[model samples]
Target chain A: MNFEEGKKQFIQTWGKLGSEWGINRTMAQVHALLLIAPKPLSTEEIMEELSISRGNANMNIRDLLGWNLVHKELVPGDRKEYFVAEKDIWEIAKRISRERKRREIEPVKSVLHQLQEVEGDRSKDEVKAFTDMMNQLGGFVDKMDKSVDIMLSSDQSWFFGMLLKLIK
Target chain B: MNFEEGKKQFIQTWGKLGSEWGINRTMAQVHALLLIAPKPLSTEEIMEELSISRGNANMNIRDLLGWNLVHKELVPGDRKEYFVAEKDIWEIAKRISRERKRREIEPVKSVLHQLQEVEGDRSKDEVKAFTDMMNQLGGFVDKMDKSVDIMLSSDQSWFFGMLLKLIK
Candidate 1:
């Protein structure tokens, strides 16, 4: 396929992938456009290209910034803010992992821990089963939490290298 | 919370958490119910508990079965098919990762690989950049693919043990 067609295909695929990763379609499309564009793009350019309203563009861009997936760029003479996505694929994955760990993993782990305090007889099958389930799930999350911490501290080459070795 | 209350809360939370992980709300709820239920539930029971229609319940249950999250059981002397979730959390997680690897990661890697063959002058900035991006993303996916394969082959205790040690 040609350049324009390839670019379009990339954005569409990225959008769908984003939905699977818990990101909304519009935000993913915006990020996809910025990721593929040769340079930083202004909000108007983003809205025009994606056929989105100004409000929609503004909201998704703000959400992207919150996710640390996009950054604000300042044009030399232009007053309007421009935005660009973190193009390095490794960095993008790290940012996503960090945010999800904080948003989803941390809270869930906390709840699982708290459930250990359920006042009940440990000998009862129902009570033991429930507590055991929580403890098992909690333990798994702890390991994962530590693993991601180690991963985020290392560079992509080192992380992938370790993963490759461990997988073998 | 008491056992029943805590169970209800856990189901609700799991359903919401499932949405963030790309499982739709109703399907997740159905899975959550089955996971906590003492025994297999018929389609009518699942529908009544979740307040979902027969078609909706059937479709989601079929989808869950396809994902290996739920299984069909034949109750003695009962004509209706009953369903049970794979209640072991580790097994549940393993099934999800395995399915996602098949449905999303593998196909995405294939496309990214094909994009490398886009016939164009390599010297052009856009062409070179797009090709490079795809290659990097593809490489990350490749590493993840291998990592998952290894994880899937092992039991939960062994896999998580290795992960904890590696991270430490």
Candidate 2:
């Protein structure tokens, strides 16, 4: 692939994958472009390379930054800001896991917890049942989140090696 | 919560989460209902409970089955197929991880591999950059999936023990 072709393929595929995983398409594409760039890219550079509008590039770049997937940069001599993705794959994964947990899991847990507290004798069985099930699910999700934390915190080589063994 | 309130809250919250995660509202609500139900429920029952159109119910039910999140139950002497969610939270998580990996990671890997095969010096640099980044992301995802597999494959006691530690 030529530079243009490779960049196109990268943006398109990354955008598609992002939508599949619940992120918006442009946000993912912006992250992809930043991920592979040799240096922090300015917003104008991103707009030019992707052929996206300035507003679109600006908005999506902000979204990626909000997700902690990309970071802002200021060169010593540069007036405009540049952006870079979290380069270490493990760190990228860790930040994503943490953000998703906050956005998805915590809210679900809160709702489930509140639902568990409602009272009534005639409906007590159903309430008890709902709470018990929610508690169990919550606990399980909590465990999975812990596993992610532990995996992220551990030495990458050791964790990956152990994970590889477990998979087989 | 009373049965009506608790049930409504559960469905609404689950539906919201599902939409945020790319699944539709009714599909998530249906799954949420099934998640806590003590018994398998028929299609008509689901339609009635959810007040969804027959086509919508059928389609989303099929999707859930496809994701391995739900399954058919044939009650003795019953002509209609009933549905139930996989009750084990760990199992549910595992199936979700596997299905998501198959849907998202595998396809991206194929694209990455194809991009990696394009030939030319300058082209190769771009191709190499995208392919290498994607391959790294793919590898990390595969490893994370393995960790999920390990948790799913563990014996009941072992799994619960981990859950206990996590909850604390």
Candidate 3:
């Protein structure tokens, strides 16, 4: 494959993977484009490259910024804003983990905690089953929460190194 | 909250969480309904509880079975087929990890491998950057693949036990 062919394949694959993980396809494609770019790209450049509408590109770029996956860049003597992705894969992983924990895991944990307060007779099978399931779900989410925290706080080498050792 | 209210909240929350993670909202809702039930639920029961059409319920239930998250149960002497979710949280986690690894991660890795063969002059910056990015991404994904494999092969207590220790 040539450079252009390879780049296209990378972007398409990344976008598909992102959509499977709940991200919008166009947004992930934008990120993929930025990831392989040698330098920051202006909005006009991004629009031409991806063939996306300006509004669509703008919306996804804003969302990516909110997620801390992409950043705005101002070129010297240039009026247009440029965008770039954080290319360090480890840092990218950590940032995504952090965002997901905040957005998804933490909220679910809160709901699980609230469900624990459901009023009922303890001996009733219906109540007992509900409480038991909640407890189990709560415990699992807590473990996942802690795991993400550890990943966010620790360096890649130490974390993966230790994990690899344990696995073996 | 009363038992009925709590059940509603739990199902709603789980469904929302699932959608954020790329699972269909109705599918996750159906899984949620089955999760808290004290006994297996029939297709009719699932449709009534979720307010879904028969076709919709059947589709999601089929998907759940494909993902290995839910199973069909034959209640002895009953004409209708019943369904149940895997209630063990650890097992549920493992199954999801396994399915996702097969469905998503492995294919991405394969594409990364193929992209490595992109023909280009090593001295050219564009070619160099693309190759370098692919290598880095390939390495990171390989590590993740190994980690998921370890999680799948180990018992929950032993896996989480070691992971917790390592995290600290």
lDDT of 3 at B90: 93
Residues A22-117 of candidate 2: C-alpha lDDT, one tens digit per residue: 788888888888888867899999998888999999999998888898889999987999998888887787788788888887888778777766
Would you list the rank order by TM-score, best first?
3, 1, 2
Cα deviation at A68, candidate 3, in Å, is 1.1
Better of 1 and 3 by DockQ: 3
Please, what are the lDDT tens digits per residue for candidate 3 over residues A1-168?
888899999999999999999999999999999888888998888899999999999999999998899999999999999999999999999989999999889989999999988999989877888898999999888888888888898888887897788655
Q: Given candidate 2, what's the lDDT at residue A41?
A: 93
| DockQ for the candidates, in order | 0.54, 0.49, 0.78
Instruction: Write the candidate numbers in order of decreasing DockQ.
Output: 3, 1, 2
Among all windows of 10 consecutive residues in model 1 chain A, the one with the lowest summed lDDT is A159-168
Candidate 3 has which clashing residue pairs, if any?
A: none
Give the per-residue lDDT of model 2 (tens digit) for B97-157: 7888778777777777666555546455554666677667666655666665676577645
Name the candidate, 2 or 3, with the larger TM-score value.
3
| Candidate number that wins on lDDT, 2 or 3 | 3
Model 1 over residues A1-168: C-alpha lDDT tens digits?
877777788888889988987789999999888887778889999999999999999999999999999999998888999998898888888899999999998988887777655767778766776777777777878878887887787788877676567654
